[model samples]
Target chain A: MASACWGLPDAFCQFPAMDGKSLLLMRRTIDGTFRDIVRSWSGAIDAATAPLQIALNALERAFTSTPWIVVLALVLAIVWAGSRSWRIVAGTAVAMLAIGWFGLWRDTMVTLAMVSVCTAMAVVIGLPIGIAAARSDRMQRVINPVLDVMQTLPSFVYLIPVVVIFGIGKVPGMIAVVIYAVPPMIRLTNLGIRLVDAQVLEAAEAFGSSGRQKLWNVQLPLALPALMTGVNQTIMMALSMVVVASMVGVGGLGKNVLQAINNQFFTLGFLNGFALVAIAIIFDRTSQAFGQRLQQYRGAAHD
Target chain B: MTDQSVPTLEDEDEVATRPGLEIRGLYKIFGPSPSRWIGAVKAGMTKTDLNRRHGHVLGLTDISLSIPPGRITVIMGLSGSGKSTLIRHINGLIAPTAGEILFDGTDVCRMSAAELRGFRRSRTAMVFQKFALLPHRTVLENTRYGLDIRGVPRAEAERAARRWIARVGLGGYENSYPSQLSGGMQQRVGLARALATDAEILLMDEAFSALDPLIRLDMQRILLELQEELHRTIVFITHDLDEALRLGDRIAILRDGRLEQVGTGQDIVLRPANDYIAAFVHEVNRARVIRLSAVATPLAETEEAPRLALPDRLVLEEAAREMLAAGAERALVVGPRRRPLGIVRIGDLLAGMVRPSGRPPTDQAPTGPRGKP
Candidate 1:
């Protein structure tokens, strides 16, 4: 292909070939300085990141610690309340029981825990950044290019650094999932806030709503549908990371899927894949239902 | 048809001036180097020239108006005329590049962020053209929002909100959301929310512009009825000439971000300041826009015989109807307490009903000062 070159590109090929390594000379020079900066603030950084471990543990326990019957009942009740439809509740109950009967209950819960934690971390970090971008054009100018790069880059290309930095573990895997999935959260949140009607914001400002009040009462509430869509996308993206995440030692249905892929075990792959779908259905419906409920109230006023 | 009843709801009395919201020397320029060109703008540079030479858009230039309280002071213009910009300045929504806005003697532009918030929460409330009701909140909750944000107790805010909801005729739809209401009803909710705030000043930025023409008129009547009891200092913004003439106690017209003319409806219709203002007011039917007092002739010794009595504040349309109904050629235009001030001839009012094509038809300029000497 290079030889052919559409018949005339010798000069183009002969043009100065920039060494990729030389391009990063500044980074190489600053690498030690970056380490020093990290070392100097390691304690504060650790303290800040420590809550993340607790969040992970909390999600794990919330999904896994309770008795199976208790967990099943609570989950069914929530599903029932959200849908207010007996048929959907019954279908969800049967689906959950079928996965349990297949001896994949523990694996399913572990996957759920990781996805839950990743989404939580994504929302926590991404929302404020999204809001900062929405509020200030300068911030948007800084973030938009970075967000565009994050979206366009293949998610796997960033994994080498994640594994190198944090080493192979659930933490590193969670970080990777977060990096891959968090962009949507930030993007949609920024869009939602930006999309708030100009007149509404004017009214809020005219009435003397404080920045904090406007954020919570007007901007956040109005942006909820968009935010919820972001959350929904984040969850789906996180779930997609299950098999890739298992490569770093996080145990879940992803591990089983990975094993099936290695050995080409069709039945094992299909069952686990079906189980993932069942779980996805549950989470998707609930969040979408909640968003719809919010919209209904807005509609109900004029109804 | 929408304005079903003739709004004979007023007694002939002039509103005493209450200088509450005053914008003095207020100017706004859009773009990076506005300060560099503002001097040029003030030195007779055109808005188009400023944009061409320096890429700066002059929004409002040397706008000064003392908006009287207990009356609607409307800022009116065609699109790109900076009427919206001027209204926002009153509430500090848009900070002026130059000059000051004094709300009840306090400068709004100089207020600290916290002070501004407090002022916004307590002192002024605005209605929007698109019925800026919070979609998440119910009609009742939306009404309670201004008070709620100011940290009024839930029960107390709800009560005040409930009273206003009923007042705006949204009694049973308290729990209903804004999206469910029609455009007119949604604006009613907007009105209720502002009224519930109990703010001293009501800034309505083209508040009725979104409604159907009939609905808009209905909203105007409702606002007029409410203003009779609650005379909040309303600063209304509109591009519609008729709405401004109907609602504004004192009208301030803006063109190309500069104040073109400021006067009563009678003043504007009878005497437009320049060609731009003259063209703007030329199409307005004087009989419908002006009152009997504006066109009434002083009773001469020979013409002292009164055939019928009408309030001086009555529009010539109503006065004409009354005079014709009473089978009289002319009617006594009385001020307060039925005291005769002047007499209005039916022929003059009939002539007024047809707006002149390009210029005011009559040489007398009965209502406002004539443009020509």
Candidate 2:
């Protein structure tokens, strides 16, 4: 009997696969092309992103230099404005005070600044793309797979590309955080817009609403709840990236946690981790409350 | 052309003066390439056959109708019969795969995008079955939506919206959101919104169908009362025969996306065009729909006309009631200016109320027309 049972060569009996050498060559080619592009375009890219860096620096400086009491009061006021709940405001105040008690207030503020900047940038970039996807099936088809990859790929994999392109700094770290965080914003916005009542849209069109008018007047208003959820999710994701972002020379609670880890300071690591959790809770509660407030009209009792 | 069968304005001069919508040879095939299948459809491919062969759903086929200006033309059909699709075509919300929608000698189908926008903004407004009011907008704001789209000044738009809101009997609910109101009230807001636009054409797609029966009757009365004053060319769509009979100055019946018949309520109830239409009208309350003129006998020169007179436009049910109340066995059916057009007896009125037992005569049949004694 022949060794090849299916009447083929023995080589065909094994699964056809690329050898390691060919795989390595393909990877090298991709890496080399990216490196060349970064070498040629680094200065131009830095200039383009200078405004983002400036904004981040300004926010960080403002948070750090401001009196601790003033900053605490401001945070409480914002929580109050968003939630209109004394309980949430008191909880946020207690968390902030606890962080300050641990001597990590400044680091907490720095992380907050970074998360805020990343979130704002993600929203600004994601909203229009999401709206485009909602309006066109072809655009949606193209965007959905990319969104899936961005969401499912390990966060560290894209950080390498970010480091290569922008070098180690706050801007590159912010870029990495946005890349890891923006899928929810884009996905929810697209879903929200697509889910608007078709009959309502028909009424809008029947009334001769121009496309721009419909988007501004009908779509955005109806999609506000989902968009707010997207904002909340982006904030949470950006906060989670703080520890990862510290590897790029970011100075924040994440940096302290990294140092603690290296030195085996369990207490210090836990303290910094608690501070991060505090910030996340405050943001999550405030944004959720604000989102609910925006949709108050939907809850009115029928007469 | 079957155009003669369509009811015209009583005064021919008014027909010439007002530019009504004339939909000619309209065919809408819903598919990836709708225009490509228009030839096969026009060649008399049945809706089902076309769908089975080409995976193209027929929305409307060969719909030719002349909607008289300043009157209600109700397009009646069951669900999936393309009544909604046909109404959408009137406002250019849905473009026909093949046809011309003529208004004021301008082909609406051929209008540029900007021109169509202008036409919809300035000439037409619509009410929906589900009352698609913006949930976030208050009654006042929702009512002003159309005017806002038209770029009307905010103050002026609100003023007009307020007037119509009050006109629709939603006087004190201006600040309430749509979710805060009942369905009937929300539909009132929808009506007010359309009315506030001051558009000449009002397209109401099952505007009252979602309401309870009593509320529906109330809405129909309100619509008729408003129509008496406004006289906008209203195109109403409904699956309810009773509603169609109540509202339509001329009724058009549709089946499987095809135009089955077009005429007045009396024409449809007394003389359906085919068995399909006859079956549709079979269970309708005929006495409430058929007017006395349809069943009245021509006044003979040798006989005396009855002293008790009723308007020829009155339905048999109402005429019978009036005759019974007056204890009269007979009445003269009067036309405009109390002119005696015919005579109707109580026996004939009672007989007219009952559905014909045998095969209902179609328009094309040679037998003498029933209900025209």
Candidate 3:
């Protein structure tokens, strides 16, 4: 293959490429090493992930077993509380009713549970990393390229490693979703903190605020809008990853969509796809409105 | 221009008892390796030469000034003259390349990180030109920021903050966020915040420079009013000469990161240290700054006492107003306890008020009249 590509010239056009045999050998070594590591760590990993499995199961069960009307009321209440807008609440109600009418409510509920858990986990993990990156240039330099790779790499590629470690369950699906969705949360948080007014930070320092005080009292509060945006993006990315995650034996609306695609059931694919979109819009709007509400002080009348 | 009489603390025994800041031979070179160029900067290198020859910017060079306790010491300079840098050094916000900031006989430059924080929290508070209040916090919360950082109980902090808020005339605006207030009101909050800390040293870096002329005057009045009772050892930084003259008990003028002159406002206005400072003070309204005692005529052997007597501390403008109101041709310039120190006529006051041309007044006592001290 190398010779074929270099056929035009002996020097300039001949790229310094590793031959196919070496490439294949390198791939086998990496694959074998990863396999050995996963096999050795599988039991410990399962034990570590047990709590995650239990929480995800409980959330899914709660969503699915609860009466549909109660779930609708809960969601509507959350939307209203976040937005304080009657219009958004009405829109959410109509969307939830439409999903129920299509008989995809149970699947939608499962996806919601998975997305909520994934977003919570991402925020819990991403915020500190983001803050560390904001505080130190060295940390940011180390994390930036890794986050780039996490965001740009194909979602299915990482799912392979996750499944190899977790053995194809909701936990593996969740790990994959979090890995795919956490970059925005981390990046936005770092950017937000870095962009806080230097004058304000200097004032914080001038007031003799301890490191923890400065972070909690100034950086975190000021960075709340960007943090909220990160959460919103994490949720949307997690939702988008659901169908791909379903390929690894995870069940939800994503599984239904995957089945529809495999069986070439166009109506089923459209139905599940629209259900996902409706969920995305509702989550996006509510979270964005909540973020804006948090920053209402910014819009107060300026003298 | 040759006479540079920097005030010494040895003479002021009363002021020495209170904690005052003494900056000794401070040099700050801003670059990756500031220490590398400090020797050159201290020896003779100019700010431009340092920045041009080496990659380092000379922030401050060989600045040594004594801030008397219970008085306002204004560090006045144009932008990039290191006035702001000098102020930050007082609180150890920016460490010096070399030299010591002596506060209560302790070297602030040598303090550990925790020690510096403790010093800043307990001994000093700062007001910024741009009013760096937390947008998320209300006026009361912002005012209590320093106390909060020191872990003061919320109720106690709020009580102190409320008193200062009302003191700075932001009484009714405690609950309003910073964005909701005007620049003047926001700076009042900044002042209140610093004041609430009750720190002996108030570091105000151009605190009123951002306000409109009227509001700046208003803030200055409030500060002066407060200082009458508070007597904080304030180190205010300002580019405005008039503001410096009005507020500073002792003013230190900076030019290109070096001290041009350190004296009372009358000293600078009457006898500038160099041509640079002469040019700086040339635009100042002499009547407003120069006092009657600086230009008063001594009481001669055969001279009779004047009918009208005015306090020697009165500025030329105020004396002129007083003399003109009484229609007196001359007045005795009396010192403390009503001792007749000198006499000054309307002609002398008029001559003193007029701006000098081309050359600065010589180091000799101001030329118009010699007071019998």
Candidate 4:
């Protein structure tokens, strides 16, 4: 039924009433008989969602409960480590501090935690699927349409099913964000591995590299830049989901921004919106910079 | 004909004469279902007819050659001529649609996955056209990759790789990545990598094609020098005739999925098997290819020539120069250990050097009628 939740709204949105039931029956059987399918997960949802719910809650609390100074220093240190750019690190520090001054610091951390967890989960799940799709034609054919649907589906559409299953919390909100962010990683990873030089692969085969050996030693190393780009896009996509997902009781910087819209307070909306943008800019610039470094390293390696 | 000699520890020299690799009745058809067209192809259907009727491209058709041991067998052809396809079959990179690739006496096509792995790791190594070095790895790492795949201990593989790197004249650049090297240097890394594996057979598929001409020549000389001592069975693929002539003890020419001719370099140039082959050989510098023994008169009872003993394998150009310098009409063409094999007259050398002047053959000629497009 956790799976059925998404199928219900998908069917509801497509036909509402117009289409026939062969497709309907197919959907029904797939998600378990359609009649009470939505309700089937009510009992099981709590247990099934427990581990993830707890994990995300702890993550959100960890970020929000930390003293402002320690979080700021830790983040700046990471940014510096990755890019080795004092300017960028300084910029990130200023941006994070500005959010604190705007009284949106706690909410900002929650949003960051949500985005981080979802994007991590997306990559963790998507990368293997991408590798599988790259390796086998049959798997690619099967994964292609599923990815197409996943990518093209509106970010808001999956929220309905997520809300039904996880019942309007950090967990469901994360599910929505992950579903939105995952496709790019999958597509780019598949494309990257597929685009690896044919002759290089032949060289590996000529050297008697086992399939696993070839993937690890040759394919993955060369695919790093493109995979990093995929990661960048996934991070951006997850960030974009914050505002929409907050409607499902996801308390964060998004919820603050939502309230600004509801209350029609110009200053509130502007400040909170600015905070969101700052966070986005921090992640986006860092990821893109890291990706550029990877590209540069890769360029040195190519003909 | 085969020696069929059993291995005796006493005669290590006999091992060098046994055939290292053999391709028998090889056919490769490219399409959705190649098996459907294999029968028609084996019965001698034209490549065009097969493609028109079945949409299957004929890549290689009935390629058979006995590649002699410890010598270079150059498979030469223009692009789309299946030379690449033929080289690939040697190391089992491409499985023939139907044929047996006999390595030593065993059929490579019949090898199981494990056996194929063992064969590739222990018997054959390859150099690629584009110098396919792993970009991220340093030159030393790239050189050690073949041995690494064979599960050689890191220290020993690195030691062997270092020696090969220096042999290819890339001694100090071991720590640099492949990207840091020039084309010639990169190819050196590629060559070192292949050689470091210590495989008995080396498959070089246009390995020097991408290098500048001077560098290409340098690499050819390097390979020749190395082969002098190593005696590895090398299957070298090339589109360039001169390179083929210089390197090949035996040359097999292919055109559009069919074997045009297979013979020694002199046999190819002096007596081409067909008109198409005649055209391929026509523009080639024949004096550089024709061996003295190829044009030599048998040692007869008529006249005792000046005692200018030359190796039977000296090319016509070199022999011509030697003969003209000595002001002699003929010279002794000596076999192994100076046993007189035959006599080569200067006139025979001059006759073989003349360019073939004639029309191209019109019957069953491959690619098209006039030979040259």
Candidate 5:
């Protein structure tokens, strides 16, 4: 089959006689563009390195060689502030300190920053698109199939497109993180808008509301709780992407875990993964709790 | 036929001040078929018989009635009787199949889109059975929503809404969302919204039916108060005859997409034009419905009559109350200008305890002694 395709092109070249020169020119242009693309990738990498180094320095200053007692105390303060359970807080503090005693805090902080940045970008881009999709049937028709493909395609498949578009850097990793995390917000927004009561819509119409007025006054406010749930899901998904994204040069606890796997350091890899899970749990709980609060306020206000 | 049965206006004030709304030969037909086939089928059947055979599902048909200004005309019917469909036609929510709806002598069916919209915003307003209050808005906001659509400034519209809300007896519920209010309260919000527009005609379709019984009574009283104060021409649709009787100055009874009769509440109850109408009034308490006119016999001359004075048009019960109060054996029935018409005695009341039929006097024995009116 390969030989057959090559023969067809070669036959065309023979027939045209000028096809050879055109093909040569096409190849040259392709090569020039590829070089330009490579140079641009290198420049972006150089620019991105400063931020990465600065982040690493911050992590290093915050966690590296810090006394286990102080780190434990900070952990206790966080756990106490969040859960408010003294025994659980004490246990968490001891556990975090033990991980730091094993020298894993710097790696955990790097993982935290990568997940935070990825989650933030995903929310900023995904939310407006989700809102647009909710309001428009045409937008939904265009977006739904794209979201289906994004969700069902293998996790590793996202890396190929991101690598081609962004080249090997933290930005490519960020792209992969965004792709993996965006579908939930879109789906949730669609569901929320669809779930608004028909009687409520009729009431708005009876009030002489214009289309825009109805959407802003009734639809968006009612959908806020569901949108918050989508945000929470997006954050969890971004956090889940952290480990896989590190393969494209997103250095973090994910990188440490990968190195530990390579070096047969079982305890170090397990600890880094544990820290990732903890951060994911914390974000997930906080967002879900906030969504519930929003629901309560909306219900009381509506009544 | 000319309405020879309608008595001349006793007082000039009793005549309609304005020709409120006039509808002419309204027709609404659904489904698409060649007219040749429909005409062929319809040719063989009278409309009522056709409706009976088909189960009468197409809402309004050939409805023509006028609502006089400052009068409450109740359109009474069971479910699927086209009352709601008829009201919807006035605001152009549902266009008539073929009709001329004249709003203060202007044809509504001929209005341009912009004109129709302005007409709806300014000339006519409606309250629905479901209250149809915008759920997200406060009572005040919902009340002002129509005014807002009409381009009234925010503060002015809201100020107007506040007054109307109080007028509808929804006084302190200004900032509360619909979900926070009871069904009756929500309906009051709807009433306020419609009234705030200052539309001359108010169309209420089963407006109080959704409320609890006690609340329904309360709302009905409030509605009567509003009607009294404003004297707006109101077209109230309800299945409940009691509600119709309590509120309507004139009542139009509809059955199976047609108007059976249009008359005063007393006229319908005491003098139904047909058997279907008779059945509607069958359960009504005759004592409640009978006025002095129903049993009154015109007084005789030649110095042989008892001296008592009564108007011929009052209900029999009301006449009886007067007879008992005045301790008279017979009451004199007077014509419009207080001319001596006849007499109504307690014996005449006893003799009238039989069914009223439109057939000649030969069908039953004489009620006491009949005399000319």
Candidate 6:
């Protein structure tokens, strides 16, 4: 009986409150229902059609993409230059080229660019705050909470507010990457400065070092190893943010993979996924190798 | 660096040196609140009483001492005996709650920050237990650090540091980092740094303790050689009695923040001031702390000099070693000028070693300053 009353025909309830308006009001009510039905139908159609367009786009980009062999050659050059070893260079080259041949280079570069921008922003913004944190306890206290929030917030949840503010775009996606990548640098800097031996500080002071002199001469140099670790972690985190960023219009390997999944294209999805891993490995190894080189040079200089 | 030349032995003798550094009735009471009311309420309280009434740590108290010029004065104590704190007071690393620390004629506690900085930069150098070399700097750069702080030209400081590094036996290792050197070598760098400052006083806080046993002995020998040349008044802090005996011209023992005793090595070892002191020295090898002059009697016959001569300041153990090495029955005990004052017979040394009493019992030993129990 309640369903019957609630579902009564629209014509009975469309009577106007004033004279000569009932018929027009009834007709308008009928039109409103019909418009709602059409909108619903169109929304479903758009949702269904949107993913197909994305796949077609991904497919076109993948074919015209930088060839796997060419990208492999570039990677080989970098690895050989860095390590002076043909075997390691060749190995890296082969891995990257295989991912590319399997059709993943376009998505891979998208992830690469995202990681690059995020890491750059993190370094630019975090280095000074880290310096300040090292200098003052008050600044450290202020930065600590922000760092805590960035570190503890769920990865998926990072997009909610970013999406609201920037409205889904590469900028918002890049911002998300920065938010995830910055905490490590700030924390490592503060810890490195704090961990510097007190006796060293005394020696510096005895030598007549002013506050700034001590920071530059003693604190910063000693803290370099730890800070490099922070940089490495920040880069790794930005890479991890690639897939998360794609949820907000970040069209990259992550988006391509997402399109492949929606279309049930197993080979396409696997290729993109493997390429993402390969890119991550390449960056991780390179950054770590660079850090090792830095350590060796700095260690020798100190010696 | 000081404008004046380093003093020779003769000049040091003529200085009429009273106390290069004096701590008069020093006190450091660590409490949450530094209020007169709280201090008064806790006055005359025992450690337990203080702990009950207010959580406090008495790091130092009534630490009256005088480190004489051109002599090595060691403040010896175990951990928590306030030896480190006491030394820190000399340079105002920690300020005393109630007392005066007079460095030369100037009151250290009263100095303004700028004045303190000037004094510290130009006049005093400290060697920590850890070598504390800046890990980033080369040995030469580390040594130059103090001079650089003093506004010396970089070239001049580098030159000075290079000279000091060579002096400390690290001539070729100047460009090496602290990490690249052995512990002993690192300490050599620290010593070079302290010496390069050309400070009037050198404060060493167990500077050799971190080295291996063999390295420590080598460093100790090196220090004696340096002292013979430098003649700087040194205040060395250590818990090792043997080290204290070996290096200290005068030794002060601290217990629970109080000055238990202060005397020359012979005085402290032969006649400890109290039970607390006696307990501390009880197990110490007496053959190490006592000196030849301490147990030796003046020569009965002035006609002939003793067959052998030994410094009056050498430990009885060293005397015994000398006697054994030389196969001599006795050695002449000499004053600072190498003048024969007495003789140390092997029999006398053996007798001294036999009865290595912790404290001189009542009515049997000299009493006053350090001998009293």
Measured by DockQ, the strongest candidate is 3
What does DockQ give for each predicted structure?
0.60, 0.72, 0.80, 0.44, 0.16, 0.25
Worst-scoring 10-residue span by lDDT in model 4 chain B: B1-10
Q: Where is model 4 more than 4 Å wrong at Cα?
A: A1-35, A295-297, A301-303, B1-14, B17-19, B292-314, B318-352, B355-373
Higher TM-score: candidate 1 or 2? 2
Clashing pairs for model 1 are: A300-B177, A301-B176, A301-B177, A302-B177, A302-B180, A302-B181, A303-B180
Give the candidates in order of DockQ, highest first.
3, 2, 1, 4, 6, 5
TM-score of each: 0.86, 0.90, 0.91, 0.86, 0.65, 0.77
* Chain B global fold similarity (TM-score) for predicted model 6 against the true chain B: 0.90
- Report the Cα lDDT for candidate 1: 0.83
TM-score of 4: 0.86
Maximum-TM-score candidate: 3
- Backbone clash total for model 4 is 1
Q: lDDT per residue, candidate 6, B247-279, as tens digits?
A: 888888887888878888777766777777667
Q: Chain A TM-scores, one per candidate?
A: 0.84, 0.92, 0.94, 0.85, 0.69, 0.70
Tens digit of per-residue lDDT, candidate 3, span B122-159: 99999999999999999999999999999899999999
lDDT of each: 0.83, 0.89, 0.89, 0.84, 0.72, 0.77
On residues B200-244, what C-alpha lDDT tens digit does candidate 2 reach at each position? Answer: 889999999999999999999899889866778999999999899
DockQ of 5: 0.16
Quick one: ranking by TM-score, best first? 3, 2, 4, 1, 6, 5
lDDT of 6 by residue, A78-183 (tens): 7766666565666687776676676666666657656766788898888888989988899999999989988999978968766654556676777788889999
The sequence of per-residue lDDT tens digits that candidate 4 reaches over residues A1-303 is 436567665665454564586878777786565335657757787788889988988998999899889999989987876777788998998898788887888888898889889889999988999899999999999999998998888877877777756677888888888888888999899999999999999999988888898999899888888898899889888887888899998888789878988999889888878887888888877887777766563567545
Deviation in Å, model 5, residue B299 alpha carbon: 13
Model 4: colliding residue pairs: B61-B257
Question: Candidate 2, B2: how far from true, in Å?
Answer: 37
Where model 2 places Cα greater than 4 Å from the true spot, the runs are A1-33, A301-303, B1-16, B292-314, B326-348, B354-357, B360-373
TM-score of 2: 0.90
Per-residue accuracy of model 2 over A73-117 as CA lDDT, tens digit each: 888999999999889999998999999998998999899889988
